[model samples]
Target chain A: MATMPASPAAPSSDERLARTGPATRIMRRPEFGAAIGAIVVFVLFALVDSTGKFASLDGIARWTDSAATIGIVAVAVALLMIGGEFDLSAGVMIGTTGLVLGLLVTEVGLGIWPAILLTFVFAAAVGAMNGWLVVKTRLPSFIVTLATFFSLQGINLGVTKLITGTVRVAGIDRGAGFDSARAVFATDLWEPYRFRIAVIWWIAFTVIATWLLTRTQFGNWIFAVGGDANAARNSGVPVHRTKIFLFMGTAMSAALVGIMTALRLRSVQAGQGVGQEFTFIIAAVVGGCLLTGGFGSAIGATVGASIIGMAFIGIAFAGWNTDWSFLFLGLILFMAVMVNTLISRRASAGATK
Target chain B: MTTLSEAPVPTGEKILELKDVSKSFGSVIALRDISLHVEAGSVTCVLGDNGAGKSTLIKTLSGVHEPSTGTYEVLRKPVRLSSPRDALALGIATVYQDLATVPLMSVWRNFFLGSEPTTGFGPLRRLDVKKAKQIARDELLRMGIDIRDVDQPVGTLSGGERQAVAIARAVYFGAKVLILDEPTSALGVKQSGVVLKYIVQAKERGVAVIFITHNPHHAYLVGDRFFLLNRGRMMENWTRDEVDLDSLVKAMAGGAELEALAHELESLGGAAASAAEEVADVVSHPTRGEDTR
Candidate 1:
């Protein structure tokens, strides 16, 4: 072999930064623009909505209370999406889980804790099936989850009818330890603040999801599988396992939300979560998650839920017809998607350069 | 630099030995009776054309697929590699053409994709970011790769740099046998040279390198022993002392067929030259070179 050339001297930090150029400049701070946009929105809303309810602690608590449930589900969906899969069944799985729990404790006379554990298991099994079908058939997750979504929706209605003789399952409040379970799941953390327990769970979920997506070995697999399935598989990342876990996570998160909702209402309805799937996905996308996968944060999704919460409450507080909420949401979704698209393009392009 | 004669006798101690390994996809035999030896600290170049079962052979070695017949040995011990994990545990790392790196992920993240180091208390533990960054930088630097930041996504690096990172990662993970699939095929001239340098570096570190490529030029540059495959069969095996660059290129390019094509082209050129000369007086010379001018 020829004599090895003298190793190129390492560049200094400044020189290295310069080597990054504009593309690296963008990559060095992929989320800076999004952060700025969030800040701008916060400021804009804070300024325009200086009215009594807008600036009051009551309004803050109410907005957060509204944001909490959606945020939890959105964070979980974000993780699943990052793992390069989608879970359309997540929203409906909530109803299934709550019904199961409601039926278990109220009708079957089972203990609350046992019912909760069994519901989680059932949710996880549904998730595992979703993942298995997707991986084994090599089908698109969008289609796979869509099928599961419809199937679960049908089951939610059909099973609720079969068990309760109606589309609603009630009498959950009559069970023993109902008060304790309600305190655990739906208790207001701060007195007079009316903050729901789901808010704490949502925040905890955001923190945990963020940690799982960034710090853990599982996080690495999530990115790998989403980023490139073949490459991840070649690297021995267990692509199938990662996707399955993500699906399970999505379902479990939905189940948790379902449990909270059922506890808060003391009843489970078949149609309760039928239309919330799109809302969760929109929040996730707005929070900077790429629908194509491999890039996102749980915090971003939480922020997205906050944005949605703000628009919903702000419009109503302004005395505008709340019917415009959907229109406003659609517009926000469009803008968020556009912004995320640009960021993703810049991120991928920067990496290539 | 040690000359070939001054270098220690290789002792025929095969680090990885494949004996009559065959594989088939349906009725088509992808590889048949392919036997080869990879010695420690030596580069074993497997040269082949587009469909000569180069991929099949590598997949078998990397545990992506099991060989249908024959025996394979690792460090002189016959063992079956059932999965990619098995191959990795056996200290065999395969760096494919795509390099198995997530484009959007940081260089260090890609470097330690599956095996990440963590530190802290309990389930709330964090990745050892400093250590991971330091190791990625050091390992790549040792391989003569001078990337700006390990924090940058691997996709930002040049193709050659990416290949170097993959090689460095394999070495850091204690890989005794490194399998590289067409590491140079997708690179430019300068980039190819850079990757070749890393291949030599790995070889110098006593790692048995399996350099798979259709490019005989690359094979000649780093290969200590060459195994040539054609039509899913082993055409020839040559030690460094036995083969020259020209012979290797010819064999890869279909020796007699290339010669025949060359002869045909040469004959056609001669005929064209004679015809041009005959028409020279009548034709305009504006397109001709200085001699005509």
Candidate 2:
């Protein structure tokens, strides 16, 4: 019942009592609590893993190496989610992009940069298809992307066997421009520690995604479309175009991860990146994104990826079974959701009064 | 005494003028020849029933749909508002009953949603949070809405408060012609009064307001000019001086038809009074026995 009192016609004592201070007036963002939680988790992990390997530069590099790939994908997925859509084909897209590049280089005798460009174009085309199907058909993105996922999965295995006569494509390092491309994608930044180039790409992606989601006009459209598509459309926002852009962005991110992985391994495996869509979504939701959309941050998605990376490494370092990682991820996702729900409830309740 | 010549000029003075606007979805005509004018610095109330063309009229004015055949004028210029952005550019902002705002977003964020200001050095430019919060607070205060915090999600506010916030936003964003669709139709008596006060505030600020509602009392309270619509057609267009409250109410309630129906029902009830009294006595005695038992 501590409500904002009605304005008085004359100056009154009640008016003075009801006035709130400026410091107390700052609107509470949903990400604030999540940021605090991330910091606390980081400190806790740092404290408990006091062993030299856990605290060392090598350990930091190892954890971040794992965190980067997931972070990149998660950020893109978060944008798509905020734009009120989903891309189930994101995970499978990695295999498709890598396979496409592999075929282009070895079978088609194309150079590395052309292969990369072609792969990106293919990724964009696939993304466009997803967007076109979703918009034109007026079908749920989940169903549309699921269809794309299965179709791409089939193509990945079928095409690799047809081109390479094997389930994997190797000798990418022997291709033209291989040395320079590998230097850019797979090079160890620190010689002794072997910190990956992918980690840099991940951080860069996070920065760009955060800027695009929070600063640009497109970001506003994304939030509006996710929050209420009908309303956004009525308000003159191009909801369909924004969603299409989001879908394409996600596919491109997955393709980038695929290229990095193929370069790092110097091989393209048809089975790579299958069944990992849920992980990207889980990471985003744990980082303080609502599955319902309209509220999430790129930084939060990165933090969520970091948490996943930490847990994966930390548990292994503790000598626990790596298979238990899924269980731990599920538990963390539940806890994060519970905490987020409570914070949102309190924030809304505070606003009402 | 006022002469018809001295009456308000029916010239190019309308901020928003809809002429013979009609819309049809296949064979069903949703709206038919709905001609209305909303002048600057005044409230033109559009009254109607559930199936009436109120929504159609709103959609047309707000640029959701192009009228099948009618001219729409803004600032006396006949222009086709193909999109809501066009309407907004012309300083015509519509605050629908549902109010286009993300309930989970902070009041300040919702206030400056599509048009957030930014400040800072290159690559470090961020939302002007301080300015946004201050402006949101000031605008709401101008509308007589004193909130405890500008940071709170707008969803937390009451229905009336949300409507007021939307009005405040429209006014702050240079909305010269504000179209509010059924703003107070969902509120309680006290809440409706609060909304009406803000509507009056918008008028006092020299903004032309198109207040659409079914409530005659609420409309009469702040509306300078009333345009009543029934079945997608204008029933009566009257100024404050021309029509009294009773007449306005009567017009909205279908005037002669409503009065005739009331009279007929009254006579029918009086004729059945003796027979109804015997039946009521028998029902009352049985009810009394049941209650006693």
What would the per-residue lDDT of candidate 2 be over residues A1-353, giving only the tens digit for each residue? 11122542222223324444443332245455556666766666666564547657887788888888888999999888877788899999988898888878888889998899999998998998899899899999999999999999998899888878899998777679988888887778986888889889889998898887766667777888888777666556777888888889999999999999889888989999998888899888877788888888888888888888887777776566789988988888888888877766654444354
Residue-level lDDT for A206 in candidate 1: 93
User: Which residues of candidate 2, in runs, are more than 4 Å off?
Assistant: A1-52, A350-353, B1-12, B75-77, B116-138, B141-149, B266-293
**iRMS of each prediction:** 3.2, 7.5
Candidate 2 per-residue lDDT over residues B1-293, each given as its tens digit: 11112233332256678888888888888888877887766777887767778888888988878989888876566788787877787777999888567666668877887677788857676677788889999999888888767866677677778788888988888888788999988886667777888888888777788998887777777878888788777778888789776666656555556445545555568656555554444333332322211
In angstroms, give how far residue A211 of model 2 lies from its true place: 2.7
For model 1 the TM-score comes to 0.89
The residue pairs in collision within model 1 are A351-B155, A351-B156
The stretch of ten residues in a row with the least summed lDDT in candidate 1 chain A is: A5-14
Clash count, predicted structure 2: 2
